[model samples]
Target: MASVRVEALTKRFGDRQVVNKVSFQVADGAFAVMLGPSGSGKTTLLRCIAGLELPDSGSVYIGDVLMDELSPRERDLSMVFQNYSLFPHMSVKANLAFPLVVRHRPRGEVEERVRRTAELLRIEQHLDKRPNQLSGGEQQRVSLGRAIIREPRAFLMDEPLSGLDAPLKLQMRAELKRVQRETKLTTIYVTHDQVEGMGLASVLGVMNEGELIQYDAPAEVYARPRNAFVAGFVGNPPASLLEAEVREENGNLELRGDGFTYRVGEDLARALKGNTDRVIIGVKPEGVKLVRAQRAPNDIDGVLDYTEDFGSTVIAHLRIGQGSISASIPPQEGIGLEAGARVGVRWDAEKLSFFDARSSERIV
Candidate 1:
């Protein structure tokens, strides 16, 4: 296993900068996930690292060796594509052995690796079956086995589990994490699914437009988002954003918006150095609370819109002052708040995220 480093990598197609000066390092044996929406340049960045797409102006280093001029074959990287690119003409065993065979590995070594890879991916029972004969999940596992059997320097996976059903996605996420840890493979995976990325990544990167926005541990990216985009994009259901103006009313900081005023703590107030007048306030579902109250100094009034119950937790959707937001309500508080019933919304000050209204940068 070896670290994979990409230095100031950028790629463009004609006029559009698809991937813009991105730089990051994956430590040896680390599971790093690049997360973003489509057209955010995650796949382009991955392709650059894999030698599939040449970066306009940057370098890719596998271990200590520069690989800018190297071909895909010369790079010795295993890439598991989204489509499960397995050969229908070949059996699972043949597919797993293909990589080694192409490299002119000994027959004995090829057979041994095929068997072990099949076992590792739990596709041993399907060894004699062609890809078309197997289920989607089975074929995907075989596809992964083919990649794993190569034992390359690093594994680059582009949404390999996206085709699976919801339950299978859950199962494969566990399996993929286990395989990476058991083999200690340095892996980089790309996905648009925040839940999937959060589950599999030791290091999570959030990207937007053509730029890498924030790179950090998944927890840090969620709890301490570097900007509004990171805060809105990282969490499941994400953070709810609201427009407001910052003010120092009577020597105490406050966030005033439609029909309500929110007090800001001293710690958070100090984080704002200058230009603190206009700001956007963000609160996670878990931070916003549902209170049965008449409009108060800091309580925003709203009407219960709807709810989403997932057995373990309940999300209360409320309409507040021309805008709507969702809050994670305890089972006890979830009841009796039906649609059209007026309610009060309050936030935990420490949990609120304040961003500059103009730049959308985090202030606290």
Candidate 2:
């Protein structure tokens, strides 16, 4: 396994730039995932690193070798594409051995490597089966095996789990994590799925409009997003944003929204003291508490819209005044909240996030 690095990478087509000055490093044996929406240049950036598409500028480094001047073959990186891309006529064993065979390794060596890879990926029983004979999950394992047998410097996977069903995807995700941990291979994964990225990647690079918006640990990115875009994009159910006014009352700061007023924490209040009256108040679903009735300060009256049950937890959608908000409630809490039920929502002052209205950037 080896580290991978990209510096000042830029890719352009015609007058449109697909990637703009993208730069990040994948530490040795680390799983780094690049995530973004469609047309956001995530795949293009991966292709650039794999040498499938050369960049117009910037350099890529795999270990100590500079890859910008080298061909894909010379870069010695294995890539598993979105589609299985397995040779239909070849058996799983043959497909796994193809990499070593093409490199002119001895037959005994190829057989040993292929056997080991298939076993590691738990596809030993399907070695003789052709691609068409295997299930989608099995074929994905075979593709991963082919990449693994190469024993390249690093593995590049582009949305490898996109085609599998939910259960199969979950199974394969766990398997992939185990394989990566056991082999300790440097891996770069490209995906638009935030769940997949957050579950597997040790480090995540969030891209938007051809540039990386944030590069950090998954928890860090979710908890302390640098700006509104990162905050809005990284969380599940996403963070809630409300248009509110910040004001000082009796020498204490408070955030006034349509139907409620919340006292800001001392630290947060200090950060927004000199800011304009209008600011965006952001909070995660978990931060908002849905109570059966009204509470003290920081509470807002609303009518429950609907409940989304996801097994262990329920997300309550509430209409507070002219705006709507969602809160995650524990299953056993059993507020029995339903559509059109009157309710109140409250959150801790420290849980609030303050962002500038004009720039949409976090205050602190």
Candidate number with greatest TM-score = 1
With a 3 Å backbone cut-off (N, CA, C), the pairs that clash in candidate 1 are none
- CA RMSD of each candidate after superposition: 1.4, 1.7
Candidate 2 lDDT trough over 10 residues, lowest sum: 331-340
Q: Assess candidate 1 and give its TM-score to the true structure.
A: 0.97
Model 2 ranges off by over 4 Å: none
- Give one digit per residue, the lDDT tens place, for model 2 in 1-364: 8999999999998888999999999999999998888889988998899899989999999996889888888888989888989999888888999988888999989988887898899999998899999899999999999898978899999999999999999999999999999999999998888888889989999998899988999998888777777767777777777778888899999878887777877788777888778887777888888777547666778788898889788888878777777788897654566689887788756566677878887886
lDDT of 2: 0.86
Q: Mind giving the per-residue lDDT tens digits that candidate 1 earns over 1-364?
A: 7999999999999989999999999999999999999989999999999999978999999998999999998888999989988888998888889989988999988988888888889988989988999888888888888898989999999999999999989988999999999999999999999999999999999999889998999999999888888888877688888888888889888778765677877787777635678888888889988778555577888888998887778888888777677899878788777889988888888788888989999877
Error of 2 at 283 (Å): 1.2
Task: Assess the local accuracy of residue 110 in candidate 1 as a C-alpha lDDT between 0 and 100.
Answer: 91
lDDT of 2 at 187: 94
Error of 1 at 79 (Å): 0.7
After superposition, candidate 1 runs with Cα above 4 Å error: 293-296
Error of 2 at 149 (Å): 0.9
Q: On a 0 to 1 TM-score scale, where does candidate 2 land against the true structure?
A: 0.95
Model 1 clashes, total count: 0
User: Candidate 1: lDDT over CA atoms?
Assistant: 0.88
